[model samples]
Target: MQHSLISLSILAALASSAVFAQEQKEDEANDKYTDRIRILGSSDKLRTLGGAASLIGELELESFEFDDINRVLSTVPGVNIREEDGYGLRPNIGLRGSTPERSKKITLMEDGVLIGPSPYSAPAAYYFPMISKMTAVEVFKGPAAIKYGPNTVSGAINLVTREIPEDFDMGIDLAYGSDNYTKAHAFHGETAGKWGYLVEGLLTQADGFKTIDNSDADTGFDKTDLMAKLKYDLSSTNTDQFIELKVSKTAETSNETYLGLSDDDFNQNPYRRYAASQVGLMDWDHDTIQLTHFIDFQSVDVTTRVYRHKFSRSWQKVKGFGNNAPSIQTVLLDPDASGNQDYYLRLSGQEDGKIVVGNNDRRYVSQGIQSDFGFKFNTAHIEHIIDAGIRVHQDEILRDHFEQDFNMLAGTMQNPQNKIFTTVDQEKSTTLALYIQDTIKLDNLTLTTGVRREYIKTHYQNRSDNANAKDDWLDKEFSIILPSVSAFYAMNNDWGLFAGVHQGFVPSSPKQNDVDVDAEKSVNYELGLRFAMQNTSGEFVTFFNDYSNLKESCSFSNASASQCPIDTDFNGGNVDVYGLEANLKHNFALTTDLELPIVFTYSYTHSAFKESFNSDFPQWGNITAGDEVPYMPNHQLSVLASIVHGQWQLNLLAKYTGEMQEAAGSGVELSDKVIEAHTTFDLSANYSLSAQHSLYAKIDNLTDEDHLVSRRPDGARPTKPRQGVIGYKFRF
Candidate 1:
C-alpha cells in the first residue's frame, strides 16, 4: 500500500509539472526581457552573475513566500529538507543524503553565524531564521561548503536577508488561521541625505491541533522577532559602512514527550496519550549585532550576540513494585520537573580584505561554560585565492542542585530531595586549517581547485566530588587533513555544466569518551547544468555522495557496566546517495499577462553496515552487512506549479517519500516500517482591493486528509492537522 501510494504521487506530480511547463511556454511567446538577476552573500553585493564557479547565484525572495523553507527546497537541485517535528520551528535538514542525521550533517548559517545550540551535540537542533526575513538561501553541497569551517562535513545553508533599497518603502501584514493561529509582521526602510535605515518586526502564536493530557493541546507556542539596519555613505565614492541589530524571543508551553510510536500504535492513539503528562512551559530568547565596512576591493565585517534559554516540564510516573504492593496496583504521582536556566554570552570579530583576521570570544555561565578564539588570513594573487583559519575553544561545566522523588501504595509517591552539588572541570580543543584555491579563466570555462589541511587537538581535566566518576576520560587528541577539488565550464552563454569531487570529515564528538572512534569522512561527485532564456530559466543537477567510517550510536563499557554513551563509535559502514533536481520559470505575454513556474525533484539512497558487530547483549547487539540506515528513504520526489495573473496567484505542490526503517531495532520488531506515502494540496490567492492594500487567503491541506508525516518506533504522534489561513497586506 505504501509503495503504491508513493509511486502514484510521483507520477501525478510529474504530470502536473509537465502540463504547467507547456502552459508557460505558450505565455512566453511575446514576453518582455527580464533584468539581470543578482545573488548576494554579503551586503556589499559587489558581485553579480559572472562565472558559474562563484559560491553565489542569482535568486529571488518572492518565490520563497509560496511555501515554507522545506517545501521550497525542491526548487534547488541537490538539496534536501526533512522535518522531524513537522514545522513548529526546529527543523531537521540534510542534503545529498550525506549520512541522514539530517541537521547534524548540515551546517546552518544566518548572516554567516551558526544558529544551532551545540554543533557537537546529537540530534542537532536548528532554527533557520524565520522564512519571512530571508531574501535568498545560498546552498553549498559537498566540497563547496568546506570554506565555512567545521560541521559543513555534509553541506551548508546560508540564509540571506533582503537588500537595502535606496528608495523609501514600508509594508505590513496580518494573518489568522485555523487552530487559533495568529501572526503579524511589518517592515520599513528608506535612504535619504547620505544615510539609510531599516526596521522590521514579526509576531506569531498558535494553539496546536492535537490535545494531550486531556487539555491545553500540545505544540502551542509564541515566537517574536525584530531587526534593524543602519547605513552611511562615508564618501561619494561608494565607500559604504553599515550597522545592524537583531533580536528574537520564543515562549512555548505544552504537554509533550520524547517518545515516538510504531505503525500500529500510530493508527490507534495518533493524538498521543500520556495520562501522567501535564501542561509545561519553555522560553527562549536571542540577540545579535553586526557592523560592516566596505570600499572598492576591500571590506570588513564584525558581529556579536547574547543568548538565553529556559525549559520546564510536568509529569507523573510509577517508580517500582514493592513487597506491600497495593491490591489494585495503586498508582503513584510526583511533582513536575524543571530544567530551567539562562545562557548568556557575547562574541565579537573583525574581517577585511587587506588582511583576513577575526576573533570569537564567548562567556556563558549556564548550559555549561565556554571560551573560544578564532583567527583567519586571506591573500589574493594572480589567479589564486589563498585562505587559512584556525579556532581554539575551552569549556568548563557547573553542576547544580536537584530533588528526587518516587511513588508508594494507593497513589503516586515522592521521597526527600538530594543535596546540592558542584564541580570544576576544564576542557580545551583547537582546530587549525589552511587552504589554497586557484580559479583559472580560459576561453569560456573556469577551472577551480583547492586543497585544505586540518589539524585538531584536545585535553581535559576534572576535579569532582563524585567518587564513582573518573577524573579524566580523554587524555589528548591528534589530527587529520582532508582535500577537495572541482571545476566549472560555461558551455556557452545560455548553458553551463559543472562537475567536481570533494571530501568531508568530522572530529570525534566531545560527548563520546573512551571509545576509539575515528573522524567520519565522505567523497562526493556532482554534475550540474544551468540554463537561462530570454523569457525562461531552469537548472538541473545530478549528484552522488559516498561515505565511510560512518558514526553509529552504540553501547560500550562504562564503569564495568555496558551502557550507551552520549557519543558512540565509528562503525564500518558505507552509503551511496544520488538525486536529480530541476526548476523552470517563464512569463507569458498573454492578454492577462500571466506567469508560470514549475519545479521537480527525485532522490535515492542505499546504505549498509559493512560487517557484523557484537559488544553488548546477545540478540539485539549484532549488526550485519546490508543493514539499512534509518530515516532516509530509498526514494523521494516532489513537484510544484504556480501561476500569477495580475494581483492574483495560485500554487499547487505535492511530495512523496518512500518507506523507511526506523534506526536501531531489537530482534522482536522489524528493523524498519513503511510510511504510506501521502499527498496534500494548498490553495492561495491575493486580491488587490486598491493600489496600497491587498487581501490573501490560503488553505493548506485543503482536503484535510489524515496521514502520518513521521512514524516513531514507540507510539506515533500526529502533527498539526490540516489548517486554513486568511491574511491582508498593506504597502506605503
Candidate 2:
C-alpha cells in the first residue's frame, strides 16, 4: 500500500513538473532575483570560534543523496557512529569518548530547536529528524559546543531544514534501489512581496535485506514526512523583523526487532533473523510546530523562538524466550550453556514454547521558548561581540507498558494471552537556562569567554505492581554553572593557532535520584592549528577531557546482564580521555573547466578509567583504573575525492574504523571480544542533462565486505552489503 501511494505521488510530481516548467517559462525570462534574509546564528559564519566545528553544506548533501545520518556524518572527525539498523533509522552517535546509546550524551536539534524526545527528561533519540529533508548539518565539537546547552560533554548536532525560497521554486527527486528500496521527495515554495511559503513531502520505503530463518515475514519499513513553512516580513523604519512559522509531521512503521542470532547462526548466515522476531514491529508518529521572530538593528540583533513537539510510539517485540529463561544475550553469547540451547530451540519454534512479548507504548512532549541577543561594540583598542541567551523549557515522557505471552507451535505463534504485568512510568522535567558570551578582538588576536547556568527540576513516578514500585516516586532539583574560554592568534593570513578550555556537563536521569548519582562533569581542553592557502585548507586539534565524575545509565536498551533494570544509574568514577582530530581539504583546478577536490579526515581517541571500582553494569563490569571505555575505537580515518567538469561529477569515498573493545577490559588482545577494524568504499556520479533535469547513481559498500559492526543489546550484527541506486531529479 505504501509503495503504491508513493508511486502515485511520484507520478503526480512528474506530471506537475511539466506544467510547472511551462508556467515558469515567463518567470524565467524575467530573471527576477530576491535576496533571502538569514535568521540569526543560522549561517556558517557562526562557527568562527576558536574551536573545532564543521558545516556540511547543501552541495555536499546533494552529492550522494544520503538519507542516512551515519553515512553523511562519516566525513567528520572526532565522531563515531554505531550502526543498529542498516538504514540508520535510529542513529547512535558519539562525539569524543561519550557513550552512544540513544545519543543521550549530546544535544540534538533541528532548526535550532531541541529535537530529542523530552530532551530535559528522557533524551533518548527514538525520533530523529529525517536526514533526507535537511538542507544542511552543523556539528560543533570540543569547547565550542558550550553554547548549545545542557548536554555539552560530548557535542551538538543541528539539522537545518529547507528555508522559504526567495523566488518561486519547485523540485522533485525519485529513486529506487535493491531490496525493493524506493524514495520520493518533492518541495514547492515561493516568496511574494511580504510573505514566503514552502511545502515539502518525503516518502521512503525498503524491503530490508535480512531474512527470518524459518519464516516468510518481511523485514522492512515505510516512513513519510511532511512540512510547511510560512514567513512574514514585519520590518519597519525602526526595526527589521520577520516572523516565521513551521509545522511538520512524520509517521513510520518498521518490522524491526532486538532479537539477534547466536555466533553459530551468524557464522552460517549473517543476514538471518530468529523466528521469534517475526511479530516484532515499531509504529511511531511525531509532530512539531515552531514560531520564530528575528529583529536586526544597527548594533544589535535579537531572535526569539517558541516551539512544541509531540511524539508517540508503540514497539511490540519479543522480550524473552520464556519466563525465568536465559536472556537473548546469554543465548547468543553461550548458546551451548546448560539451558541455553533449550531456550533457543523453544524461541525458534522447534519445540513447544512460550514467548514473552512487550508492548512498549510511550508518549513524549517538549515545549520551550528561547531568546537570543547579539551585540557588538568598540572600546579603546579592543572590539567586543557579546551574545546572550535564555531559555525556559519543559518536557516529559509517559510510558504505559505491558507484556503478553504467546505460544509457539509448528513454527507459528498462537494463543496470545491477555496483557499482564502492566507498568506506568512518567518522567518530567522543567529547565531554565541562561548563557552569555563575549568575544574580544584585537589586531591579530581574538579571545572568547562564556558562562552558562542551568537549573532543572525533575519528577518521576512509577505505578506498577512490582516489588520496586514503593521506591519509584521521586523528585530532584539541581543547578550547575559551566564556564569556557578560548583564544585564537593569527600569525598571518594563512596560519592561526587556537586553544580552548571548557567545562563539560551531563544531567542526571530523572528516575535515578535514589542512586545518588551525580551529574557527569569534566574539564575539557583543546589546542589546534588552522592553515589555509589558495586552494588548500587544514585543521588539527588535540583534546583532553578530565572527568570528575562519569555516569552510566541503565535504560531500556542498555542494562546489566543479570537484570534489565530501567532508570538505574551507575557511577563509573573518574575517567580521562584524550584524542586528536585532523581534517584536510585541497582543491585542484586541473583545467579551466575541470576541478578536483580531495578531503582527508582522521581521529584517534584513548579513553580510560582513572579509578577502579566494581560494578554490576554489563558495559562497566569490573572496572579497573586502566580499563578502556567500551565501544570507543582508537582510530578512525576517511578520504573523499571528487572530480567535476562541466555538467558531469564523480565522487569516491573510503572510510576505515579501527578495532574497538565490546566490553570494558584492560587488554587489546583479540580475545578481549574486540570488534575488528573494517573499511568500506563508495562511489557516486551525477550528470546534468539540462537546467531542469539531472541523473545520478550511487553505490554503497562497493566491496561487499561482511564485517561485524556491533555486539550489544543482542548478538552480533553486520553492516549493509553492496547496494546501488539510480535516481532522477527535476527543478523548476
What CA RMSD would you report for each candidate? 15.8, 9.4
- Mind giving the per-residue lDDT tens digits that candidate 2 earns over 1-52? 9999999999999999976964464233112111011222333343345888
Clashing pairs in 2: none
> How much is the lDDT of residue 302 in candidate 1?
20
State model 1's lDDT. 0.48
Clashes of 2: 0
lDDT over C-alpha atoms for residue 692 of model 2: 98
* Residue 525 alpha-carbon offset, candidate 2, angstroms: 0.4
* Candidate 1 displacement at residue 339 in angstroms: 31
lDDT of 1 by residue, 286-388 (tens): 4544444332212321222222222221221111122232110011011111210000000000111011111111121112111111222334523433333
**Candidate models: Cα lDDT each:** 0.48, 0.83
